[model samples]
Target: MAFHTRSNSFPSMPHPIVQEVDEHLCRLRSSEAASTSSSSICHKLSGLQDLHDCVDKLLLLPLTQQALAKEQNKKWTNELLDGSLRLLDVCSSAKDAILQTKECFGGIHRRKSLPISLLVEE
Candidate 1:
């Protein structure tokens, strides 16, 4: 990446790609700030648990009403009665990804401790 100027704003127009990237970076920084606000992994996992509870509550709602709540996929006709099940699917995928990452790092920590064990044996 190349830094073109002090700012991306132009008199008549803006650089769309740069603007999008900057917005994404800002969001990332905000999320980083939020995640770093709590140092405990347990806290974050508890948050995930809370999300799961919300999902369970959501499950109590009728499928048609649930689909109607999601505006992005709502159609003009009978489909308006339908709910986008994608929300649960996406959330579950994200949860899986987070757990996978935790497992990967846990394995890495165990691997790092192997040398310490070898040192102790020596």
Candidate 2:
């Protein structure tokens, strides 16, 4: 099933970076049903990476910089910053966990491929 895209609903959000991020999010959501496979996980991770790249590009825009500077002290701004920090922390932790799991699995595969004699030697 196809997921609804929110970009059209947000006509005021004309920036290309915002649109790119929205597209990535929509694609990720639409593919959620097939998320059982490693390839699907990789696709979702790539989408998230694209979203982060879009966010970095958005931050580089002069308009974005000015708006952030203009409202840096507002409550909403503070909340946004706090939320972004939390997201960053969660992403970092997730990356670490994924790496650890991958390493563990790699070791398992390596052990499984070893000759029986080599296994006994270990």
Candidate 3:
């Protein structure tokens, strides 16, 4: 039997598909940014043991949510929520790390600024 391949005449990225793809890329970028920020904060705050634990907890948030959403068969919502939660968790972990580092080194809370509130509101 001969294998057949489809013709390469498909239309270049349909408008809706392009939009969806763009949105997903943006989400992935945002998630990456958050993860980087959290890791940086953790590195800076390596002196604080509690902050390390907090960061670990936050890192698990997205994984937990994704698993639950998949079990519930909420594919679209799960994807969106997983992205959002990952971002939120990373930001939160970073903030906690920064705060703990400041507290250990300076004896006071120094919160790191982040845009997490906007996502929480949604």
Candidate 4:
């Protein structure tokens, strides 16, 4: 079988999931510097969760599954599968980390009278 390289050009109109992912990423980037409060951090984590959801939707589409299944090259498919798995893993880890941070921060934020050292001692 002959192997042919495909063009990397994107369609004139991006897929809806692609657009969603872009929007979430742009929002996250724009808010990065202004994330000083717990609410802001929660909002950013929500955006990350939205991006992860977009990826999950994209991967589950029949067209995407078919494309991966039909690929003649095992290497490309393997890499794509591996990359997707890694992406999901990172997203899960990030979400958990953010939630833990929010909890700890919120706890300390709620206890305004306590010193930092006192909070740590507890």
Candidate 5:
């Protein structure tokens, strides 16, 4: 016996409110392209767009902002850490060079009572 699987998917449909908003936006653009446009109409449409954007933001998952902030903070932290590590490596190299210089000249001490500056001058 063969088993049959049923399809549970539904057809996609545009939301009525979304369709209305799109029509309103198209009308606003068309009016703007037509002869001298009134600034007040443009201002109202701008405000409406801003309100729609705010509503869209409200619908996003609560953790989205926190995740974006965390990602940016992590990027900044990595940059600071990388810069500190580079500086540390430079310091380590300088210390090694100084130590190697001292080691090379230690066996050929000309004056036992002189400071390193005087010994170097000698």
Candidate 6:
């Protein structure tokens, strides 16, 4: 399946850093899926690293009272919702990558399967 791209619904532009990080993640995942051997696992690891960077950048965005007030006044942007959905898609892709890696490594124990929560935190 193709990965879903982030929606551009918000009136305000997304923090440029967010776009860069997301693009990096998408590229990493796509490349990994086309590769063989440990390279795919390495790509997934790189994607996680990029995700961490994105989180850090997101935290640095202005969350001051004035900014929050303005944000509250504006209607929920489509871009914001789209970003969230895109992140969810990334999470799913990451989980699949991990599972495939584990299976490739023969770590799958038929008697004790890992819980879904292991892939997605509740």
Best by TM-score, which number? Answer: 2
Q: Give the TM-score of candidate 4.
A: 0.56
Error of 4 at 69 (Å): 1.6
Provide the clash count, candidate 2.
Answer: 0
Model 4 agreement with the true structure over 8-122: per-residue lDDT tens digits:
8867897988788888889888998884676776777778778878878987888788877875856788997798788779878877887899799888778887766766754
RMSD of each: 16.3, 10.4, 16.7, 8.0, 25.0, 16.2
Q: Estimate each model's TM-score.
A: 0.35, 0.68, 0.30, 0.56, 0.31, 0.38
| True lDDT of residue 33, candidate 6 | 49
C-alpha lDDT of residue 1 in model 6: 88
Off by over 4 Å in 5: 1-69, 110-122
Candidate 6 lDDT by residue in tens digits, 21-93: 7787777767754766566666666676677677666646775224535756445445555676787787778
Encode model 2's per-residue lDDT on 1-122: one tens digit a residue.
99987655545658878888788888878887875655666667777778777877987889777777785557766886787788689778767877887899999999999987988854
Q: In lDDT terms, how accurate is model 6?
A: 0.67
Residue-pair clashes, model 3: 0
> Where does candidate 2 clash, by residue pair?
none
* lDDT measured at residue 85 in model 1 versus the true structure, 0 to 100: 49
Candidate 1's C-alpha runs over 4 A off are: 1-33, 36-83, 116-122
Model 3 score (lDDT) = 0.55
Pairs of colliding residues, candidate 3:
none
What ranges in model 6 sit over 4 Å off? Answer: 1-38, 63-78, 104-122
Spell out the clash pairs found in candidate 5.
Answer: none
lDDT of each: 0.54, 0.77, 0.55, 0.80, 0.57, 0.67
How far in Å is the alpha carbon of 4 misplaced in model 3?
A: 33
Better model by TM-score: candidate 4 vs candidate 6: 4
Q: Which stretch of 10 consecutive residues in model 5 shows the poorest summed lDDT?
A: 35-44
